[model samples]
Each structure stands twice: as C-alpha cells, then as structure tokens.
Target: MVPIDTPTLGDRSYLAHDGSVALVVDPQRDIDRVLALADEAGVRIAHVFETHIHNDYLTGGLALAEATGAAYHVNAADEVSYARTPISDGDVVEVSPSLRVRAIATPGHTFTHLSYALESVSDDGIEAVGVFTGGSLLFGATGRPDLLGHEHTSDLVHHQFSSAHRLADELPEHTHVLPTHGFGSFCSAGSTGDTTASTIGAEKRQNPALTQDEEKWVADTLAGLDAYPAYYAHMAPGNSTGPSAPDLSTPESADKETLATRIASGEWVVDLRTRTAFAAGHVTGTLNFGVDGQFATYLGWIIPWGTPLTLLGESPEQVAEAQRELVRIGIDHLEGAATGSPQDWTDAPLGSFERAVFADLAQVRHHREVSVLDVRRTSEFDEAHISGAVNVPLHELLDRVDEVPSGEVWVHCAGGYRASIAASVLAARGVHVVAVDDSFDEGAKPSGLPIAAA
Candidate 1:
C-alpha cells in the first residue's frame, strides 16, 4: 500500500496493489500523481474505489477511471448522478489473482459510506491485510457527522457510533487501519493524535471512539467538532452531481490594464506571495492569502462562492501550485494569473502595512489607541486571548467587518496566518491595521499583555 498525502487538505489517498494489478481509494482531483505512481510501480490500475461521497475535496475517480480504463466503484446507496459500478455490503472485487477487496457498509461519516478491506487471497484461504476506513474510523477519533448539516447531526452520530463498533468487532485484530481523514483534516471530530497508520488491534485498545460507550462517544464527538471551511458546503453536491474534470492548463497572463479592470469590477485578486513580501508591497486593493500558509482554506473561507478570481504570484511555479490547491476545494473560476513583483504587474503605488511581534503590539497598546482583534476560532478565543481583543474568527471577518471599531486594529491569531488574513481584510476595507505576525502564546505572557481566561 502506498499513501498519497495532500498536505493542503490534510487527507490521504491510497494505492493498493499486488504485483501487476492495483486499485486507488479516495483520490483527490489531481489524478496525475496517482497515474505517475502506477506507472512507476509497473502496475495496471484496474479499479477506483470511493469509500464515500466526499464532502471535503473533489475526488479524481471519474477522471482517473476515464484515463486508466478502470471501473469506478461507488456505494449503491448514494444516488450519485454519474456512471459507476454500484457496490454494496459484502461485495468482493477481485483485482488480481492474489489481491481481493471487499466492500463493507460503514455508514458513519455519510449515510452511504463504505470501507474496503483488502485481502491476500491464496489457494488456501483469504487473509485480511488492511482496510481503508476513510472517515468512519481514524487513528484516534472517527469522522465528524455534522457535515451533513445540523438536521442529520443526531442521526449520523448514532450511525457513526454503530459503524465504529462494527468495524472493530468484524475486522481481524491484525488488519492494518488506514483512514482518509484525521491528519489535520477538519472533517475529523478533532485532532486524532499524530500517527496516521495503526492496526484494528491498536485502535480497539486505544481509539476513543471504539473504546467509549455509545452515548459518551456521541456526546464527546459532537462536542469536539470545530468550524470547518465554508467551501465544504459545495463539495457533497458537486460529488453527487459528478464534478467535471479539472483543467490544469496554465492560467492566462493578465496584463496590468486587465488586472486593474477586474479589480475595479469587484473580482477577487489574491496575492500568493509571501506574507512578509505582501505586507511590504502589493497591488492596492488585492487580498493577501500567501501560498506559504493554509492558502486554499483561508481563501475559500473569505472569497464569495463562484467569484471570478485572478492570481498574482512571484513565479509561474507558485501560480501553478496555488491553482492546484484552489481546484481541490472546487474554486476553479481562475480568470487569469500574473507572475512578478507588484511593480512589474501594476503601475499603482504599492501598499504596505506594519508587522509587529506581541511585544511591539503590547507597547503600541500602552502608548496609543488600538483595537486588538483576535482572528482565531471562537473555541480558541474562549480558551484564552488578550484581555481587550475582540474575537472575530478569520472565516467570519468578511461579514463582521462592521463589528470592528474604526481605529488602528492590531490583529493576531494563534500564529500569524489568520492574522495576516484579517489584516488584509481590514486593509481592503480602508481600516488602519497592524498585523501582529507573532505567536499568541508569547503575546499572552504576563510580561507582554494582559491575558484573559474564559
């Protein structure tokens, strides 16, 4: 088994093969990497299996199947409006003479979710090797059930509880557990330790979802859920309706005049340069969602759905990378791209902002009037924050801009990424802003600023 890790989405796709034949599970929209891996391994990809209709990233199943002449396998229960070989519980698929995969209806993360158990089938019998649990079970926690919307939350949680125990009870103790979510993925109920690979034996002994009583498990899982990116709402429908293949052609270069016109017409002009570089100089009205940080998540959170966007990057490679990340979240309306410094791309005078450490912010607060805005999540803010800071999560800042009083707003998140986002939003709104590009822990020190505990 080979794991394909997409760090941007914090998800994993797996290629399981036995010598000449292989199958891909939960692949991302970019199918090139999976193709390359299969080519390198000298194996034919005969099938693509989706454990569930993903609500996080666009799956490359259809495109991959089209390219490889492989059959796409989806759960029969999910009414996906696309061509696929509908699989049901207990259905066994033979990939090769030695490799066999069985679909087990998990039905936790989604109502129609399936977990595939790969086994080595010899003349003697079959031995289970690994199971791709997808979002049903993770290293420490199970997939959160709230993504189906609030109405299904209670029912899904109940299903999740039953599904987790079923996997534990049915799978062999030695079977390897591989999950698609929970490696920094927002789809997870919470952080599931750090390790990504484990066995059913290990999980049964240590996984909270498997060990806790059903009621406690449901309560804890529900309580631990955090706010996910706004773009997630579009994924389920896109997957159900069958997402179109991604067009990875190089984005056309937008000349200075066209860029300016688009900016004037209220198009999203995202600067994919470094945050420090963005702060030093940028096109006047552009928002900085630097590629160096959680670029796609923050950009998707703030940008309106279906907004035509253009990219400004330091190089062609940066623009290409940013485009790939954007496509994963279904943000594909990239109108054009420009690669150069701010001056090379535009004739307008460059904009700049002050970047401060926590100590600098503390001194500024002591000396002059400043509104400290904490752009971390409400949970993070409730745990602890600066005494006078107004909590406006980065995801909610665009709509709640008026809540921030007019003044020099000193913005900070746990680190600086969200703070940079908040600063850019405030700057675009013509609010005086000082982005505190420093650690919140250092800022909350007794020697620095007054810390408020919730």
Candidate 2:
C-alpha cells in the first residue's frame, strides 16, 4: 500500500491489491512521481478514487483516468461535472479476479464523502483486507464537519460520528487504514501526533475526538479548526457541480509572452516549481506554491476565496494540477490559461507575492515595529506559538481586528495560507496587512509581538 507520509516529496501514493488489480485513492496533483513509480512497477492503475470533491489540491483522478484509462470513482451522492461512476455504501466494485471494493458513505466532511473497503482475494473479492479512509478516518484524527456549511452541523456531526464508530466497531481490528490527507492538509481536523498513515486500531486508541461522543466531536472540531479560509465557501458550491476539467494531456510549456499576458490581466499566477527553482528566477510577482508538497492547501489560502486564478507553472501538467488544486478548494471560476509572457496581456496587471519561509521573518522583529498575527486554530496557539504574536485565527480575524492596535500588521500561519487569508480579511476591511510564514511551531509564542491567544 502507498503511504502518505513517506520519504517521497509527494502527498501520498497507495497501490492496493486484492491479488489481481490496483486501486489508487485521492491522487493529488503530484502524480508524476507516482505515475513514474507505476511505470516501474509495470502495473496499470485500475481505479482512481476520490473520497470527496476535494478542497485541497485538485484531484489527479481525472488526469490519472485520462492517462491510464482508469474508472473515475466518487460517492454516489457527490455532484461533480466530470464523468464518473456513482459509488455508495455497500456497493461492491470488482477490480480483478481476486481484488474487490465496497463503498461506505462517510459524509460530514462533504455531503457526498465515501470510504472504500479493499478486500483480498478469496471466493470472489470477499475478505476486506483494509480500508482507504478518504479523509473520513485518520490515525489520530477525523475529517472536519463544517465543509457542507453548518446549517445542520448537528446532523453532520452524527453522520461523521456514525462513520467513525462504524469503522471502529465493524472493521476488522487488523484492517489497514490509509487516509487521503495527513499532517499538513486542512482536511484532517488536527495532526494526530505528526503522522500520515495509522492503523484503525491505533486511531481508536489514541484519537480523542474519535472516542468522544458526537456532541464533543463537533464541539472540539469546530473549536480547534483554523478559521475557515475565505475560499472554503467559494470552492464548495462550485466543486459540487462545476464544469468538466480541461484536459492537458502531453502538456505544453507556457512561453514568456503568454506568462506576461496572464500576469497583466489581473490573474493571480501561482508557480508550482520547487522552492529552489522558484527562488533562482521567475516572473517577478508570481506566488510560489510548489506542486509536490502542500500546493493545494496553501494555494487555497493565499488566492482569496473567489478571486479569478491562473497558473504560471513550469509545464503543462503543472498548470493542469494547479487548476485542479484550485478547484478542489472551490475556486472554480477559472479564467483560461496562457503559455507566454505577461506582456502578452495589456488589459489587466496581475500582481505577485513572495514565498515566506522560516527565514526572512526576523525583519519585522528586528525593527520591533511590526504586528504579528497568527492564523492557526485556538488549540494550536494553546499548544505553542511565536514569542510575541497574537492568535486571531483566520475565521475570526475580520470580526476580531478591532481588538488589534491598528498598525502594520504582519500575519503568518504554520506555513502562510491561513496567514494570507487573515491578511486578506484585514485588507478587505481597509487594514494594512502583510502575510508572513513562521511555520506553525515557531509562530506560536507570545512575547513583545502583538499576537493574541489564551
């Protein structure tokens, strides 16, 4: 089975076998690595499954399907524009002579969320060997309940609770658990002790939220979740029933002229190349959210929820993955992409934002004249924080800014997406803001920095 937190730079890759075929779960935009591995293994990907209409990176399922001709699978209840077969709880799909899959409705993370049980070969795909928990269940965590909007949070909580409890009580104790998202993903409620893959048994023992009753589960999740990125709402409705994804098979490289036009036309250009590659030289102003790592989640944070987005990547697949990743977070009002320079477009002038790493942060502290705002959840602040920062998670930043002293506010998060959203919230309200990246651990402390928390 392909694990999420491997030595590889990619999100996660799993190849499950019932002895005859392979099933791939939630292949994020970083597919080249896995595709190459697939080639080496000499195995054809039989099924590409997405647990939900993702909100992190765009689903590579569509591209993987196009590339390998695998059947694209999603929960029957989910609505996406792409062509896919409906998968539901208790429905068994035969992948090979020995391997088979049974779908389980694991909603609450999303309305149409699902989990699949992979069974080993027997009389005919009978014994479930393990379950690929598509953001439904994790080693030390579970999926968030607010994705569908909290109108019926109470009900969604029960749905999620039921799903988790079912896994705990029904699934075999030895059944392997592979979750689609792990530590850095906004999908998981929280890091369950810095891990990506964990067993169902291990989760049942350690995950406090999983063991809690439904009431506590919902409360803890809502309380600890980082403020909902502004993009959350925007991406959900669009992804629910959006347009078919553009096919970028045998991708074409964008030229300097096309790149210039894209930047000028007021589109946010995201460079999905490696950080070192990005830092070496790039079109000035392009935001650097790398592809192989946490692109989907971070990109959703910086680009504002409903802003028109365009990609300025190194290759055609990079561009397509960027587009898909944006859509996963519900940013589907996509404008067409160009393959040339920014000067190609004279109508609009798109701006750029620099990559903020663990370094370059002391500038504000050195001056002792900048305000630091932390955009992680309240629990994260309680766990740790930067020496002198405030904890105004992105969700409350808009309403809570009145508490700040009103100065040059420099916002930051574990990386920078939430901080970017927090900064955007302040900017939209006529506040001067600069989003920073202090990682999450280093930014959790409260010193002279004007950060907020308990």
Candidate 3:
C-alpha cells in the first residue's frame, strides 16, 4: 500500500509513494489538478516525464514543464520530433535542488518507455525511494508489448523479460511501485486486479509477468495483443512527431455552423449525453455515450481512436470534462466541442439517424427479421444476453463475421461504443448495423427486454 499518496489526478496521478514532494508521471492534457495539488502541498513539481509517446493521453508534460519551468525527460532510445532530455539505463536526473530521478530503460511497452527511480539516500546506501513505472509495469501486470509493430516483437519480448527481472532484481525491497494505468485499463493485462502499487519483493514473488522464463512469456503475451483503433494510427504519428499537448481544461465551444461543417465533412458525431437525454432529441448519426458511461472507455471502444472527435454536451464544462475523459482512453486528435445546443444541425432535414430503444428494437427484431449480434466479450455473452443473439466480442468480431447472419444486423456492447465499432466493421463489409441505443450498461433491462441465462 503506497498509502494512497496517488490521488488519481482525475484518472491519473500527481504524487509518489511518500507525498513530501510530487513526481508527475504521464500527465494528461488537463494538468490543472496536478497543478493545484502541488500548490496545496506547497511543493514544486520536482520532475515531469513521459513513460513513452503515449497513444492514449495527450501528454501535458511539455506544457506543464513550460508552465512550471520543470525539466522534461523521456527514453533515450526515442527521437521524438522535439528537444527532450533523454534518459537511458542507469541515468539519474536532479529535480529542483535535492530531489533526483534515476531512469531505468524499460522498453517493450513502448520503444521509449523508461521507469523513473527516486534516488533517496539513507544511512544504509543509495536506493530508489519509489519507481514510477509508467505504462511499463502495473501492479497485477505489465504494459502490452504489441502496441508497436510486431517486427520488434521478439526484441520487445527480450527487453520486457529483462526489464521485469531488472526491476524485480534491483528496485529496493521497500521502494513503492507507482504505475500510470490503474483499473479498467486494457493497456496492461489483469488491470482489474485492483493492486495499485506494491513493493519490489512483493511484485517479484507474485506478479507472473515478472517471472524468469523471458522468451516464452514474452511470445505468449504478445501473441494475444489486440488491434488498436484507426484513430490511434492518426494520433500516434503526431505524438511521435513531437510533444503535442492540448489544454484539456480549456476546451473551446464550436458554433452550429462549425459543428455542421465537421458533421457534413463526415466526422463522427459523439454526443456526451445520457441515453434518455439523447433519445429526446439529437443530431442524426450522433452516437450517445454519456459522461457517466466510463466516458472514455466507451469512446475507446466505439470511436475510432484517432478520429477527429467533436464533443457535444449540455454545456462547456461538460464537454471539457468529456475531452479529458476521451484523452484518458487514448482517443486524442479532438477537433472541438459544441458548448451549447446547435439546434440548426438538428433543424435541418438532411441525413440523420435516431436512437434504437428496446421497444423499438424488439419491434424491429420481430418485424424486420434482423440478426441480433451481441458484441460483448465472449465471457460476458456466456454469462447472459438477449435471446437468439450471436456472440462475438468486439475485438474478435471482424475476423468472425461468418457468425454475423446475412439478415439485417443490430449490434450492441455492454453499452454503445463496442456496438458502434461492431456496426462500423459490419458496415464496411456492406452489412448495415443498427446500434441499440438503450442498452446503457451491462445486464440493464430498461422497461421491457428479455435475456436468457447462458
């Protein structure tokens, strides 16, 4: 237990194991929370570092560094299109006056991923106070090695094997391990274990990801890596180009004309409103996954990762929070957001789509003879689902389209994002898909819907 020194900087963190001073690891676009915490603690941010060129959160390290006059550090192996202080194996950096960070090159999660070691000198010897393993090692698991190209999968596995052992062998027995990702993050396997931070000795003993059989472990782990979204392809190129940080706290509102322009140009419309709120009235083709729906998780699933997203909500604050939420799930490349209602877009009688509720969906399934495909994870479908629904997890849907019946297809996830992605995949195959709008959360029965025990 790191004593909850990490206050989930609004889904990220600001503190290390000991809260005397703070080390901001992988700060997302809106760093106001971190800034405020540092201010409250009456301490300056000793150092700001990126674990690697994140495909998920738009890094605020550079911006935060500029604002606070802190030194920015990344992996020495990475040559991201910006001037950054590089850190390699056994490299230590001084933060402010007395604090120091030792960089341990832990590649495999990303080409440029490095874990920062806090050099706290004691009567015994110089040892790291805490290890900030950004996207490299999680409490229950480690980062996915296949995020990059498979060309280096072998090298990554080799490095990851060595990297885990390196941390296991070297990090102090009491040194705290703080990971960038927490629960609900697919970046690391077994993230749902709820083990936030653990001692080096504890991790070495328990974490299966850290055990010795390097080659086989790496091969097996990397083999099952899932495909990233199309949006990530776009955002990564830019993230690699240089330090691109968006002011997440200050998302600007777009007018109706601007919203219409983007929508007309065929950019996907993401309505960050509740299902009931969206069903009342919404622009046609706009997908609704409310801020309450693990906002970014749904965005990560449904919206193409790097697709130029334009947020629409009841207000500006809501949209800003939505953008930050999207960043948390690695969906960068945002366009802008509609602060107020762009009634003009809805007023027009152009191409539009509506929400598909349970009643409407039931009537359609009975009336039109459609193939209801449930795209939840196989385990979830095996648990329970709508009757006669085909089971195919969103990640595996594209490969197993044969299971998708020839008739009209209506897709759904625990919510809507997975459904949207499934629908998109089916649509590309020339099969039209209707996303069920009312299935907000898993096992939810809104008014009238039936499910069979699996």
Best candidate per TM-score, number? 1
- TM-score per model over all chains: 0.97, 0.69, 0.74
lDDT of 2 by residue, 1-454 (tens): 6553332212354666433356788765445655776766677788978778765445556777777789978776765666787788788888887777888878767767788888876755367678987777876877777666659666776777788888877787778887776655566676656674567777788876567777777777767765445555554444455334434343334455665666567566565666545434445546556666656655665454556565655556667766655544445555555443334422344333334544455654675676666777776777666656777765565477687557776677776645544553454355666656555555433223334345
Off by over 4 Å in 3: 1-13, 16-22, 96-98, 123-125, 190-192, 244-265, 294-309, 325-345, 348-370, 377-410, 415-417, 420-454
- lDDT by residue for model 3 over 277-340, one digit each (tens)? 5545566556666776556654565454456777788877788777766654445556777755
Comparing 1 and 2 on TM-score, the stronger one: 1
Prediction 1 TM-score vs. true: 0.97
User: Each candidate: RMSD to true structure?
Assistant: 1.4, 6.2, 5.6
Error of 1 at 302 (Å): 1.8
Residue pairs in steric clash, candidate 3?
9-12, 56-330, 231-305, 231-306, 232-306, 284-353
Sum up the clashes in candidate 2.
Answer: 48
Least lDDT summed over 10 consecutive residues: which range in candidate 3? 1-10
